[model samples]
Target: MKLSRFGGILSAFTATMALGLSGAGAATAATPQARATGYVALGDSYSAGVGAGSYDSASGSCKRSTKAYPALWAAANSVSSFTFSACSGARTGDVLSKQLGALNSSTGLVSITVGGNDAGFADTMKVCATDTESACLTRVAQARTYIQGTLPGKLDQVYNAISGKAAAARVVVLGYPHIYKLGGTCIGLSEKVRTAINAAADDINTVTAKRAADHGFAFGDVNTTFAGHELCSGSPWLHSITLPVDESYHPTAAGQSGGYLPVLRSAA
Candidate 1:
């Protein structure tokens, strides 16, 4: 009877040890990689998600949205510690002073979307409306030149400022997503205007990409990633001008999910 009791105890102990080993192996296999730490977002209304998303009442701006790209990126990636300093009217200068404050050595990621405000693209569109294609084209060309010359240096400032504050953090500067496509048209637009705007956007992205590269930051080209989903195509990524005007030019919820999330994931 004593020998039988001892054998039973020995079998149970062996089984417990085997289970522990298996559990440890499974944990090792399932462990998620320790990615970079806190995520910091900076920029303008595009980053803010002004017109088409849920605003955070606590953020003290019509600009800050809970559904904005930064928020979405953070949620999707399970990044709990995030600092989003984006505001609706933010410009290049705005970022250097205000946004850089949120970054520190513990920060792992920084994402920015600027230059549109500096170029005054929104104001130009407001003035030109959809009817004045020639004026629109002219304004776009002038803005392109200004951006090409001025934006690179400003981008360098943003990069340097961020690096200064958060030496180990990876900086990512996102390009504008395509709001217009070749031969596309809106309620007040002709095909000519659409082509010109699309071309100008491409030029803007080119300058942004080059500047980001020079500054040793990652360039998130959401423009190329969203090539087929421009507003005129009836795609959900961008809003068409005639009907849900608020969402026009800005990225849609789908855009944030599909377009921007990939960039954040890659940055990590």
Candidate 2:
């Protein structure tokens, strides 16, 4: 009788301890990540979801796609407010003037994929696609030069602006993926061209990452997720000299859903 009572008490105590620990663990996990109530998507074509299709007519010339990573994240999280202000051909100045309007003290989250357009990504791809490897390398070299010299200051301005606008927001600066798979078959460009293109992407990402870190923002690099999925991998996530002219060399719908979405999710 006495022994039974003791065992019952012991079991009850153990169960209570377990529940207490479980509650603490839950709290620890939940408290670290601030709830993102309001989100603003900023930056250029990648952020606008240009090549992913499903364009929102309201976005007009911006070519904002409903399938972009920012949209996917907002839909998944069901944030209180989401502003998709990213445009197709935006540069640092564009973000400063047009996109910053969406940010405020109440903004809880921000995501951007800029610096690419500023680094002349579109023209670099155009050169790589239509010109010889020598020309491609030259264009890529110029882009890298811009990235090394001028991009840091531009990024600093934008990051500071974002921080100033959304004081408490958790900013996640997403990056672009390598366009081609080196050593793989290219319809027009060669392996050397692909390598140079990928190298330029690396340079931009490195610079962007440094700037993001300087501003205490998270840099969501999609390159790792995009590996084995670059164009000429037999399963490509990006477009190749695509139609509509604007879609060329951009991520396809699959790229947004599979590549970019996961990176932002993990960072955000």
Candidate 3:
């Protein structure tokens, strides 16, 4: 499939680390261990760390780097082996089948980052590039309606499949942070559109969180720790519109450290 024109530049720059701890407050301060006795990763570009910095040559997928949260979390906690099946542009159904299907009795820990592209956040930006906030908001509202109706059941099915595959594994469902702030800019769109996008992101997180709980999986809310730290806010976790290398609607390297890392750590 041809890369979307907006995301093409980011694809060109695709590329993408860790620590440990100990303490009296060991539960919090101590390094959280990977649930996987045998690790396996799943999901999309964010999980793959597409624009967060560097690519893994062996992975042969754009911008999939070692420093991405999954790899970093695994190394920090000392997971000796893992299989990462995360790919750019993956949807939940794709994850359930292609990524999760690769697992078996040996798999222990599983993590996933998904739902945004399925909600068409990226596609909305493409259509609203020359439109008004009202136009974009309309698009967002429509998208949300479609997503809320469709995604929950889809997420449930995926989670159930994972549970069946690795009953002992800790399934981590990583949620998205605010892609834009209350009011932000880029490519001529308005703050309202950004807010709409952020709100929609919240919706995906909410549904995913519920699904995780239902399936006995861990839910990681990256947005909570990143409160007020959206892409428009000077020290944004996501990339600025002008940064050609940063994926059009994704996080930057800083985002991986400031945003993604915390979410993974919280899971620990």
Question: Pick by lDDT: which candidate is best?
Answer: 2
Better of 1 and 3 by lDDT: 1
Candidate 3 lDDT by residue in tens digits, 17-115:
012223334657456544447778888889888777678887775457787887787777766577778888888788876887657666777888878
The order of the candidates by TM-score, greatest first, is 2, 1, 3
lDDT of 1 by residue, 1-268 (tens): 9999999999999999999989998898889655558889889887887655777888766368777778877877755389889987789899887778877767888888888888887766664575367787788778878887887787778777878898778888888876766564565677777776777677778988898888788888886568788766767487654433544567777777677777767765
Candidate 2, 38-74: lDDT as tens digits: 9999999999999999999998999999999889999
Runs of candidate 3 exceeding 4 Å displacement: 1-36, 183-187, 242-246
Task: Record all residue pairs in model 3 with backbone atoms less than 3 Å apart, i.e. clashing.
Answer: 14-63, 15-53, 15-54, 15-55, 15-63, 16-53, 16-54, 16-55, 17-67, 36-109
Question: Ten residues in a row with the worst lDDT in model 1?
Answer: 239-248
Relative to the unseen true structure, what is the C-alpha lDDT of residue 94 in candidate 1, on a scale of 0 to 100? 90
TM-score of each: 0.80, 0.86, 0.79
What TM-score should be assigned to candidate 3? Answer: 0.79
The 0-to-1 C-alpha lDDT of every candidate, in the order given, reads 0.77, 0.91, 0.75
